[model samples]
Target: MTDSSSSPITVRYTCPHCDAVHSIDRAPDLADRSVTKHSQPGWEYATPDDDLEVRETADGIAFICGEDGPVTDLEGKQIEGCGRPFYLNFVRFEQGVELDPNPATYGGPRFDFNG
Candidate 1:
């Protein structure tokens, strides 16, 4: 897994009440379109705006505090992948990209790739 912190479009969310920022990472809303890349079929997606409901920041973006972390929804934030009452994440990994998992219990090689 490669460190995505410096990814092209890295996102983060913050809590307005307690000022506690919970990185929200959820899937996108694409019901009518099928994202296929090199035979890698992407999943469908939807956003919170569809339902006219705003989540936390309403920034319309999703982000994970780190790898292996629970997904969160920025609510009102405008994130790339999110929907009505979202709690997941959606992202497109371009070709030649690398992923570096965080240093947690699941330890092994510093990085990995499906192919």
Candidate 2:
């Protein structure tokens, strides 16, 4: 049996604007830093006027816009509203089993782990 604890963990980040997803393999030491970075305002290049809300989900974590909401596009620098919320989903792969290429399809970042 393989020790799941030491297995590589994949973190998927979904964009609220275009439903575009970005996935990154989590390094044990840098996990907290990655989470903190995503939990900050304008992390997605959103306007500074907007507030960010962090919530703990079964899977990993979620970052959503507060009252002001998503008021700008980071890449385009436009004032378009992306009302959708972003999610950070975590998944573990068993030994020899291939990891899913698209973690976004795992259904909105709901994981069984508390942290």
Candidate 3:
């Protein structure tokens, strides 16, 4: 079998406001570990943490952009992007990987409602 950890999964995201493109390489093993953290007790119902840049959701991973941008290149230059945060939804089967359809908005204003 091949080592999935050694292979870096490339995830490319396009800015919604601008046409600038951004790409990131994520380790499968690390991504899995981050996603697994979402399952901890009270994690789902917890409030959003502003300090977190990257967070895992029930469906996939979210890339929270800062005031500067999302990621930088090998030369330490920030990639050209609109700086708008986005998400990549994972379409998984059993234990293997599949396709990521498109990037979605990362976050927005939250409101509490009582029924």
Please give the RMSD to the true structure for each candidate, in Å. Answer: 15.9, 13.0, 10.6
What ranges in model 2 sit over 4 Å off?
1-58, 65-80, 92-115
Q: How high a TM-score does candidate 1 get?
A: 0.18
TM-score of each: 0.18, 0.27, 0.35
- Stretches of candidate 3 above 4 Å error? 1-5, 27-58, 65-80, 92-115
lDDT-superior candidate, 1 or 3: 3
Lowest lDDT block of 10, candidate 2: 48-57
* lDDT tens readout by residue for model 2, 1-115: 2233664354444465454444444433322322222333322232222222111112344545332333334443435345455544334244966344242243357565776
Model 2 steric clash pairs: 59-111
Top candidate by TM-score:
3
- Quote the positional error of residue 103 for candidate 3 in Å: 14
Off by over 4 Å in 1: 1-8, 25-115
User: Candidate 1's residue-wise lDDT over 1-115, tens digit each?
Assistant: 2233432232344332222234433223311111111112232333433322232223222222223233344444332332112222223333855322122112333554678
Pick by TM-score: 1 or 2, better one: 2
CA error at residue 98 for candidate 2, angstroms: 10
Give the TM-score ranking, best first: 3, 2, 1
